[model samples]
Target chain A: MKNKKMAPIGVFDSGVGGLTVAREISRQLPYENIVYFGDTARVPYGSKSQNTIIRFSEQIIRFLRTKQVKAIVIACNTASALALDAVKDEFDLPIIGVVIPGARAAVEATTNGKVGVVGTEATVQSGMYTKVIQGMNPKIEVIEKACPLFVPLVEEGFKEHIVTREIIEYYLESMRNTDIDAMILGCTHYPLLRSKIREYMGDKIQIVNPAYETAMDLKRLLEEEEMANDETTEHHSEYSFYVSDAAEKFRKFANTVMPFDVPTTNVVNIEEY
Target chain B: MKNKKMAPIGVFDSGVGGLTVAREISRQLPYENIVYFGDTARVPYGSKSQNTIIRFSEQIIRFLRTKQVKAIVIACNTASALALDAVKDEFDLPIIGVVIPGARAAVEATTNGKVGVVGTEATVQSGMYTKVIQGMNPKIEVIEKACPLFVPLVEEGFKEHIVTREIIEYYLESMRNTDIDAMILGCTHYPLLRSKIREYMGDKIQIVNPAYETAMDLKRLLEEEEMANDETTEHHSEYSFYVSDAAEKFRKFANTVMPFDVPTTNVVNIEEY
Candidate 1:
């Protein structure tokens, strides 16, 4: 009787990094139907050009539109850095990107007024995080580093390995001497590397995951818009996964990050749309 | 007077990995023109879905066609893994991908009868290298590891850190006992991580670079087709770089990789095409 609410919320990433955000969304809003699109075919948009990213984002959005999604989350850092504005302009749906949430969290969490941001080359270069934080408080100093290898390490399921830890420390070593109170895991994949990042940066430095915060924001926004599904029916909400390249790899990764069983992951050719 | 050839040979990757291949081709055949498209906007296609990869590949090829490239080279492993066939069929241009040339080289280099192939998830999952090598000699044993982190490390410009060496050792530890005669750097970016990979594997193992081999193959193919550029005049050769995301990063990376100066690295919106 609630107008048979069935439209799914669409979320996209360059690859499995967005799974962190998707997992959080699923956990926090279990009643809502969700659809995830990972452009695994062209994952790690972090180092690409804005135009190519904008095009890829456009194709992905167009494909998601076909699935009848209510809103879109650009869970990829590189895409968010380079193409979020273009995507939002192209689509009338409520669009959310990790950068904004990350900037907000960094601004709120930094006690020493010195905050560090670490992500992919694209995210750091865009200066979006620095701009957003500075816009909030001009006195805050932001030190940014691009930890590009973290995404590949996480996707390869090497999150806890000593080698992965060593790599994280090496990448984070630069941020060590800086007097920063908080470090935003600007890229979603950075959250998976948090254990090592925490060990390297010490317990004092707060590691902010924009994905978790973005999910929380998503929950609040849905409630405010009266679009939150109220169906308390015992049926488990469905999550349909779509990927651009390899379905098997996506499934394997989903098993690693997802809390519940991913019943169906449909591989769709997004470029055709 | 002979007419000067001006159309660019379009080279594309999900990210900067393709630059290695492009560099080799540019060096060996400078007379031939080049135009590179890095989908840095969306990278790490290794763990993506096949359908989406095909879609992305199609879009890239379609975009390249607009530049009227005489030939198309898919420098991205994930795209080559899933979309090479579709790409070849959809486009009339002579298309070259990294898999076959690397496989051929691995087969030729292996003396112990066992060979190892290291690449991104998509390249390993496609099993194209294994099939190609085995097809050459069924007796050759092939071991494949998806070294996803390597791409990010290379992109982040962390090729020579002790931590990177540690990560490489961690990934290659399994290969120590395998007694592989040759190891193929299947991903173009892997070549940049050569020092680390070589340090772990040792001088005993012959490291094969697909990018170099692919360049040779391109040369051979062009000669066979009688399409090799005949421009022998000084300064007649030209190189143009295009990226989907940021122009500054592309210029910086071009400086690092290119043998000659890249006068201009432009950011072109491939999506609009």
Candidate 2:
């Protein structure tokens, strides 16, 4: 399946939240080269209109095309919700989005047939999770709340704190009253706040993380397509990172999340391409 | 005291929150050029470490230096709280941060000498606003709360809504009990939630927006330096915008925030520079 020695799997997100997905892909397929584009400058795409999200995502896909990626992962919840269909139509490569995998996982995990979805304003507004889940089982009840602060709280590194706890409790107040068996961490960054989320929701509710499930799906897809790299190649696989904004900040964040060498990351300007 | 053409005053923030500052600057200094860089990708810098904030501030300052800016306004509360000192030492140009201007304005507005500050976790944690307010007037009592979700809520375009109102009420519960005469919209983005903030605090508590005060200070500085651009100029005056992530999204936000078309806007991977 390994015909090309140089082609990379391209992954892009509005910002660092997509790193959760990228980290998963790298862990599952260590041999495959990865070229990641983090639109650190114009991230948190969840609040913008559908037309704007599509336009922004198209530019990212166009940028990735230049990198000659085998497939593109729309690793953003907002983009996945609003622009996935259009992106699939526009691009020739296999395009995967977080919403479907997340939706499927949530549906599979739900025992009461009641699912809860939380994300940015844009994601909640799209009703992507509801549509996908309904498509599979129309009987399932879906409850959605836009926890808009989760992204910034994660980005700001508020994984643990009394204030964070207070905020999480306040945000999850709506779901507590609902009869939801499973809750989808609809946004990629939501995983970082999982402990806080879990604490607030208690042990009864199941949590679904699309980033993790999507990684597993990607592994299966590669094998089915005969695109998996052979084990014979002894060369150390490389990851080239590009961020639309501060490279140093990305390096710091990469170190904190992935525990990798900072110097090796190469920052590229996405617009110039 | 005026030159025919002087470089526009450069203003930068983590996201559209800086628009409040930019709009004010444009209003006060109609004749000058304005260049703004919003690190939208890694915004909500309030929770990041001092070192990371300083590093990010340095990169933005370096970028603004290329524009030959007469002065630089660190419109971000997180950056101002954590990195303003290092920024002032590193650059010779006139620099202003929202915290001091905001603190000063709050102190001036408070007839009762009670001031409240609300921002992201890092800004509140650093005690930057409290220290600045105390530095101005030690007798003035300051109450600080980290309204972590405020930025994300505003960014998500949740300016007015029932749920948004509910969340604002929940967050402002502490302030409602406290007797604060005036409150500083510490974060640049906080002003966008003005109605919500105003509704919660009521008219009795004066709200001081640092963005507005910062713009006035910037205008005064330009005039004092004799660098103010005159009305008569041979070349067409225009504003250029840059972001670290998606150009399309930035353009849309810029269009919404600015009444007129931005001459040019693009996403550049800031690390390559």
Candidate 3:
């Protein structure tokens, strides 16, 4: 149990988008060490097929196992949608994905029982959010939208720009008409555009940030399984970052999204795993 | 020489974006067969480093060699910008990139000696177009802009949509004021947004589709090298398509961009090469 508590938690995404999840996890569980892997070389996994996403996720998981992670967080919504189930049992560690946690949050948050989901094309197409939300309560209506431009907009660093606002409005126009009391930001990158999305959706509608909820979920799971790191230790926890390409670029982007400084980042040839 | 004339010309882009280039090549060189590979599994080489792009391009070139291509066209602007020079000497065939042809055409078309170049972030950052254009004529001024959203807009099939127009105007607003007489669509996907871009820039600015110019350049090179396919063969030229993932998606996109029929597209595990 002591050794298990000291092991780092593995978190991964197709790219830096998953840093949002990592940030949230660190905020929620400050004592836990984290090892994050971003497959920057073959990013935007939302456009990829289920088989490819699964294969890539499997490879990433295999790589993370070498780091001796006590648990794994599939921080990417596309990978969570397509690859999570297939890989959940393959590894002995606790494997949690963003989909179920976000869905659970939406189910609990929705006052009108009409929930909206916004994510990449692949995630929306997977219908994982809809399945989980409906499974929780069949009466709840799920509206899934694929906002393909949102990710590009965020990557371009257009968070508060008028163009980003216009795009958000354009994507969420239909969802606004429906009485969706809660909206799940199904993509990790979507949280970066939170203000614009909230402005467009109005204050009445709850914005569900899966990263935050997933972090909370991870905290609960760790506590339940006695995997939480011992806070009694005087040593500070470390967070290590790895990407497939452009470590400098990833570091720059990481600084923008992450609250704490990322002192060093290593580039891993993800194909090797 | 006779056998060389029968061999297909190889063209490749990181993904289906190069279908725009393939369509132009087919239009210009009707008698020449084309073997096109879209590295769909690991695409958008724009964000990757020069070394990785060169490596991926080398792998693709090796695969194309197996198809007995007489010449090769690096249709991806990012690849042409970063990987072309590195791989040119590695192959015996006449290797062409969209940059030189596009730069040549821009130089020819720009009466005011001011040319605007738009492409992916990496291509624009590489300064390949600016260097090539300025090298031809030192007095010519080059303004390069990275329109990152354009590709996602086109992929979402928003070519003529108002959102696309707004985004284009937003991206090109600075270039429009610079008194440039021409703009090079440095990325193959940009050609699809030609009409909207033209409307934004007005009638005076010539929109250079590098794909078309590259095709013309290929035609000129084949003639110069005496490798033009003999039309007397009394056989129709065949165009074969290959992608690393989602053959059906690539086929659907090819149908939309390609004038002729693409009956089938094979999936290649590019890593194998």
Model 3 chain B: lowest-lDDT 10 consecutive positions: B157-166
Model 1 per-residue lDDT tens digits across residues A6-56: 578889998788999998898888887888998765566776656667888
Off by over 4 Å in 2: A231-235, A259-263, B1-150, B153-187, B190-273
* DockQ scores of the candidates: 0.56, 0.18, 0.71
Question: Candidate 2's residue-wise lDDT over A1-273, tens digit each?
Answer: 344434678888887888888888878778877788887655658765676678778878888888878777888999999999998998888889988899999989998899999988789988999999999999999999988767766765656645567567767898888889899999888888888898789889999989878887877777777776665467677788887666777878877676456465555555454
lDDT of 2 by residue, B1-273 (tens): 333246767788876678778888777777678888987655657655676678778888888888888788888888889898998998888888888888989989999889999888779999999999999999999999888777666665656645567667767888989899899888877878887889878889898888888887877776787777886457455677887665677788788888678756766555444
True contacts kept of each: 0.92, 0.26, 0.67
Q: Please provide, for model 1 over B156-195, each residue's C-alpha lDDT reduced to its tens digit, 9 standing for 90 to 100.
A: 6677666677777777899877999899988878877777
- In terms of docking quality, model 2 is incorrect
Interface RMSD of each: 3.0, 6.5, 1.2
Query: Lowest summed-lDDT stretch of 10 residues in model 3 chain A?
Result: A157-166
Report residue A226 deviation for candidate 3 (angstroms): 3.2
State TM-scores per candidate: 0.82, 0.64, 0.96
Question: Which is superior by lDDT, 1 or 3?
Answer: 3
DockQ of 3: 0.71
Q: Please give me the total number of clashing residue pairs in predicted model 1.
A: 25
Error of model 3, residue A53, in angstroms:
0.8
lDDT of 3 by residue, B1-273 (tens): 889998999999999889888888888888999999999989878778887898889989999999999999999999999999999978777899999999999999999999999999999999999999999999999999999888888887777567787788789999998899989999988887888888889998989988888999999999999999986467799899999889999998899889988899999877778
